[model samples]
Target chain A: MLLPHWLFSDRAGLVLLAVLAVLGVGVPILNLWVPPDHPLYLSAYTVTVLGKYLCYALLAVSIDLVWGYMGILTLGHAAFFALGGYCLGMYLMRQIGARGVYGDPVLPDFMVFLNWSELPWYWHGFDHFGFAMLMVLVIPGLLAFVFGWFAFRSRVSGVYLSIITQALTYALMLAFFRNEMGFGGNNGLTDFKDLLGFSLQADGTRVVLFILSALALAGGYLLCRWLVSTRMGRVLVAIRDSEDRARFLGYRVERVKALVFTLSAMLAGVAGALYVPQVGIINPGEFAPLNSIEAVIWVAVGGRGTLVGAVIGAVLVNYAKTWLTGALPEVWLFALGGLFVTVTVLLPYGLIGLLQRREKAA
Target chain B: MSELVSELDAAGLHTPIEPVDATHGILLYLEEVTVSFDGFKAIDNLSLYIGDGELRCIIGPNGAGKTTMMDIITGKTKPDTGRVFFGQTIDLLKLDEPSIARIGIGRKFQRPTVIEPLTVLENLELAMSGAQRLDRLITARLTGEERDQIHAVLDQIGLTEHGGRLAGILAHGQKQWLEIGMLLMQKPRLLLVDEPVAGMTPAEMERTAELLRSLAGSHSVVVVEHDMGFVRSIADQVTVLHQGRVLAEGRLEDLQVDPMVIEVYLGAGDAYH
Candidate 1:
């Protein structure tokens, strides 16, 4: 039996998500079996591309929480993601001890080369993966809380709020890029030997990382889905439409905005932590303003208010980037810029939104 | 008449508002209230009291500070200097807008400000109760009791048959009634309605006056209106505001003949007849 329509009324959506997940998990296995010299043996590169896209999807979901629902368009999302990655990078560097080019057992090679005798006090407990993960979450959460507390309490919204967010990320980028900041200067931490005591180069480890990425994406989507379906979600929409009316209706509007913004930052942090391991690099470049803008474009091009659309947009955009960068490397940035303008001007509702419109009309 | 209907629809209509027995007890008490806007005293040294469940009409020409006075009471505008009390013990000055709303005080603006895009039923549903927290919002599924309360409000507002229709599509008179229905769902201890019949048809005006009269038994209502005939039909007492101060106060019949009231009305009495 084909099953009742209600039983699988959203069948197309379910099938699409399932197909993406299968493709995600299948790439690492293919990489293990295929020879490196064959034209079809591009599984390793595929894994790297998809893993990075999953990280972007996670960040996009975080942005949707604030901008799509709570009406907070944070341009500081890259800061939170960088903070999480830096935390993980700290742990990875500690594992390199004597193996580093400087061959200092008690210190990171950079510290040894720089002739630093001791680690910074903040870098103390990062040697443990558990503590590093905790730091990843806490560092971003605290920054978001403090930033939101001051900005929201002032009742800032609209363009003013967006400017402040941009300034926040810009400030962090400058701070992280400083040579004396002990965050690997501009280069950041890289060249990981192992994570959880498993060799990162092993196929089994790669497969496990791919599975984790899929799990993270699914979890992020579900969390956002639950949030936007609630009464709080309705209140958020109300705030977006008419803030003054929401206030008169008995909502503590500022508090609601702050709460959602902080939660969004924490989610971005987790995505950053995941991105560093799979990509095998973490740098101050991750905090660039353009990266944050790219995230907004992802959400906008996918369908701003739709949760699943963000993930689909992230994957599709990155997949297109892989093909274009290899074939038309010189014009890739132009194509990306042109695509954004086209989507904004003619496809404001995006692919998923267009589908929804068709469904409604039909 | 169409203008009146458009105005009525803008203001949102209501149920048969009944008066409470406490109408003679103690209604609204404001002491030494002062509000300023742009260095101009909107309400200067204003103090007023209303009896419980009483229907009182406030009349003032433009710039009389009538709207400012309502703003202070409903927590929209805070006074630079003054104290406001709800019932016997509630200190209204310290409460924010949502807190003030929770304490059984409802204010209807002169313009119909109902949630426009919601279905009539959904609008009523939103107004049925208050959710104090986001968790409450998450768990707020409509129960059978809530459904019954919503249906009763619809019945009283004469929108029972139009529940499924979008509130945005309602006729002017019907929209006004829907807004009134929203306030009714709160079952407020006191109701403040501004310009209740400004552009309403003769039929809508009569029905509204009748509705206010019916509401007089269970709830205390203070209506600010420019329509003397509408006020004469419903107001038990009248207060006249002028230049940000109370100029006169008494029964509608008494104010109708007062020289000060006549001056404020400014040859507009011919229309009332």
Candidate 2:
């Protein structure tokens, strides 16, 4: 929606914007205005599901920024996502104030339960929305910068980087699980009550958040579009295809990879921050290696390089997962694993490739 | 080490402000450069020099360290012991691969790499990003002059018609030419070309020679080729390597008849044409 005119002129881009606009506006009306007993009434649960998908869409776009565009297939991207969620979660926990069972003003209930006398220094400023927002962007951005700085400068690439990223998230998961780590033990941060003083239980606030998630998804898509349109984006693609050739052409390949990597992490951070409020909890479970792997599969199932394909992949896969877990229950993981295998073999470009083929056939 | 070629420059016409002027007339210098992969020395105590705007061709039988030597100069392979310099001020060993290119030495690989997914036009665009890339990434659209420059290179490489086509779909020879054209787009002061005409047809070889020759007065070029006919066609001075050291250095005709060169290069078969 914020795109400059010349950049926003693509027909597919326009269609995506239209779909997002409709969803952003219509979903709120359906959730808030229509009475629940009506046939076309949107359920609150459906609103939450759509909001979760939007956040995942943002995560998928973030992953695509590096994996699809630059070919850095990270398996630890969920680490950044979980970190961002924890940051916002800390702020929400602070907002809980004296209402907790432990009734400690500064320490979260978990810290009080652990007999911690004071707020940890790292957890100090997250109570402020401004500081929390900054942390949402910076912590993941800084970690990615440091990680990518070492990895890319050393020219570690392909599967090696992927392994390193997996190790990164797995390490984060273990550290967060420790009771001494001060991030709420294995349960992580939860029991959020409000955001900016609006009741988390309020349907009005839920509707607004759902709308905001849609807006963010649109913004992320356009941001990626702008990036890939730039000369830097072309340089990334060149690096992806041939790093040595791009290096010989004097691209400062490490810097390019680091820039995209850090930015991708920040975007994932935003998604995780958005994700926590709607889901009503953010746990160490979000940092699971399986979650990151699932995100990669979503991008693959959508289309590796296409930004729109990532959004489609995330929504469709999650929708399928949600539907399957409720209906068949036991077969979700097998279905997901099978989906990944099948996509790799038959639908190499995922659903987007299939659509393009159908369009040509038409 | 290269023979003094100041006389060649005094007769040549080129950019008024040349990238190489001092440094004792050498554009590139490698002294006592040694590199080992495992215990085997791929480049052993080798020293070489290339004069500015001099189209020097290096020819050696297999494993003469030709590719490895290019690697050392371009900062891909670090040497165990050596002083490598570009012009005089820039130390080639100290800078990374991209910086070597930024300071005006572009290299072509042994195998062609034209970034198959990118179009010929995009390949040129990316090559243009070697210098001042941050600014280009933000505000640089090809100025009319810059677009014209790409057009001119496209015409030179005879791929003007295929600028929009992805390089993957190009003919094998065209891919080679596209990579060369990509190097050309950077407008590097020196270009290290590796086996440029290896699999080219005779006509393509002839045109490539013409292209290389036309580039000599403005750009220093180091061409390493195995094709004796191609080397003879475009070499200004030939450097022959045998066992990671210079075996012969002179005009191709003179080196071809050198009995020492014949014994080292031909190996009793007299197979080299």
Candidate 3:
């Protein structure tokens, strides 16, 4: 029951954080170096699952920054994630070249098989990893900034803001599902070949991608921690507790909300970017509003306002989903719904919240 | 950005100082300020000033615009017309609520606004943190110095014993004091506290009045209170507002005898007057 004192002490805390960061880097490398059949080997399947979990943690951290701190509950964060994934996926698709099932050198397999003449106008320059990476961040950041600027300035909040956010994602999903829109319609962009220069299917590449994902998680966590620790962080907490009081104190409440919202969206985008390469697919299903709702559930299950809790919740919930879906596929939706109700009703802080309470009591 | 009239120190009646000054720092100022809501004048041509480090009481009837005046000064609601200033340099009308706050203006609503889910200590910490605009950068561990400040503020507010307790669990008076403690952490040069004794027992009222009086040396406090006895205990000067204007201004005794104040509040030859 005792967490290491280093986990809580300041100097020791940083040491522990460093250790955790090292372990984060270690996991993917461990998977790569140790033979797959070795007793300690986490297996490709395990690495993929855990890698995906780390990505989810990034998404949860993003949600926590807005919903937990700034008091802006976004139901559309998954859309940002999907946009990032699509951007990365586009690059991967470009790398496929003449290797696609349709054997087209320039067009992606979907476009070629569909007998399309060329790459869509919006798909330009995705062959460069740098441009794709830039798109991964910029696209989501811009969308969040514009949406948040309008919503926060208008004072849309609480349930209304959450509803509007959900509506936004749903709209994106519908648009992406349309075939003529050039996003591959219902099938989405797939059949990726490489990233930068590495073959996407190589285990070495997968392990490196996993390491990158872990590094991103650690970096995102540190960044969020730094933000909340600053004077600006306290202001976000204050805004979460009371908006009008914060506004009265002379904080540009709308600007603060917009900034936090956009930052959160970017984090989600990074998560999505990492997710795409590891999963080897990006689809319109990624933009499904329900996926975003699940992200919220992850935050709730872990702990609503606690960032670590959000991460923990995402891992725990998704891990359980993997097991439950495999074991009882027919009832998985019921289990998921039941889990939400049970967590929201009984364990409002989810598992992490419960642990925090116990720690406080101790 | 709207044009900000630097009328805060335009009268040159106030001298600039910290904590407390020679009654001239102009901690809070309003000149020809008018606040109208939907064609109805809530505060009309209101003009008032609270000197630096002065514990001034604003006593008025129900519709006296006392709360609205605080709103204007804190930049919660802009005046229909007029100048509002914090110190000699800053035009409050030019700022929004958060900017006014960063400029060291603190306001406590009549109701306690501490987050109930948070402990008293946590509430104070959140208040000091203000509003963070970044998400990915807000999760750093609390520093020792920040912890020390929270402890000091807790002790100063007499809530050291209750720091671990939830703010919602505190009595009304204690909650009020906790909010005041929260405002104190910002080390605000000026504090606008509305009705610090509204729902308190007499003992609580007395304690609160004592608390507000104690804050005088370190901060300029403008307390909007209807409790005359409480005002008498804390007010160095009292201003009575009516129909959105200053009806009377002076020491409590002087206002008690003002004919115009009597006419507005007491009516002619009232037994209380």
Candidate 2 vs candidate 3, TM-score winner: 2
Q: DockQ for candidate 3, please give it.
A: 0.35
Name the regions of candidate 1 deviating beyond 4 angstroms. A1-16, A34-42, A320-345, B1-24, B59-63, B109-125, B128-130, B161-179, B194-214, B224-236, B251-273
lDDT of 1: 0.78
Question: In model 2, what lDDT does residue B264 have?
Answer: 74
In model 2, which runs have C-alpha deviations exceeding 4 angstroms?
A: A1-9, B1-19, B129-132, B267-272
**What are the candidates' individual DockQ scores?**
0.35, 0.60, 0.35
Question: In angstroms, how far off is A306's CA in candidate 3?
Answer: 2.7
Q: Which stretches of candidate 3 lie over 4 Å from their true place?
A: A1-46, A112-122, A356-362, B1-29, B49-54, B85-90, B114-175, B181-189, B201-204, B214-220, B242-273
Per-residue error for B220 in candidate 3, Å, reads 4.5
TM-scores, all models, native as reference: 0.85, 0.94, 0.80
Consecutive 10-residue window with the lowest summed lDDT within model 1 chain B: B11-20
Model 2 C-alpha lDDT per residue in residues A6-112, reported as the tens digit of each score: 46676666787889999998998888888999887898889999999999999999999999989999999999988889889989999999888887777888998
Each prediction's number of clashing residue pairs = 24, 0, 34
Question: Who wins the lDDT comparison?
Answer: 2
Question: Mind sharing the TM-score for model 3?
Answer: 0.80
* Candidate 3 positional error at B104, Å: 4.1
